[model samples]
Target: MPKKIVKKGKKSHKNKPTSKKYTKYKIDGDKITRERNCPRCGPGIFLMKAKNRVYCGKCTYSEFESKK
Candidate 1:
């Protein structure tokens, strides 16, 4: 067996949620809104908001932010 190659470039990380689950919801003039949900995992599963990307822990799915 040989040593596995390590890919270079963007790194992957696991960041804990900064706020409580309830804080993820918002109320605006009687209208309720919630954080974006993971498309791959469907509803009831919220996506974790990072500085530049949104991630899904259950399926390791991620989306990067576009540079302005």
Candidate 2:
């Protein structure tokens, strides 16, 4: 008989998705919202919103946010 192996101190991150990674545009009373995507990578790939820029993880394309 083979003994079952277990990994210790590892978090089960696969079960839950991170909320910070997703953001959708809201309208007056619309139930449907669209997610922002990277222009270089098309609609399938999303852009990462950082402190100062929006970045695409796939093609390394980045655009800086304008300062107000």
Q: Each model's C-alpha lDDT?
A: 0.82, 0.73
TM-score of 1: 0.53
Model 2 regions lying over 4 Å from their true place: 1-14, 18-35
Per-residue lDDT of candidate 2, residues 46-67 (tens digit): 7777898988888988999899
User: Can you give the lDDT of residue 6 in candidate 1?
Assistant: 92
Worst lDDT window (10 residues) for model 1? 16-25
TM-score of each: 0.53, 0.51
Give one digit per residue, the lDDT tens place, for model 1 in 1-68. 99999988776777967666666688888999988888999987777888999888789789986789
Output the lDDT of residue 27, model 1: 86
Residue pairs whose backbone atoms clash in candidate 1: none
lDDT of model number 1: 0.82
On TM-score, the candidate that comes out on top is 1
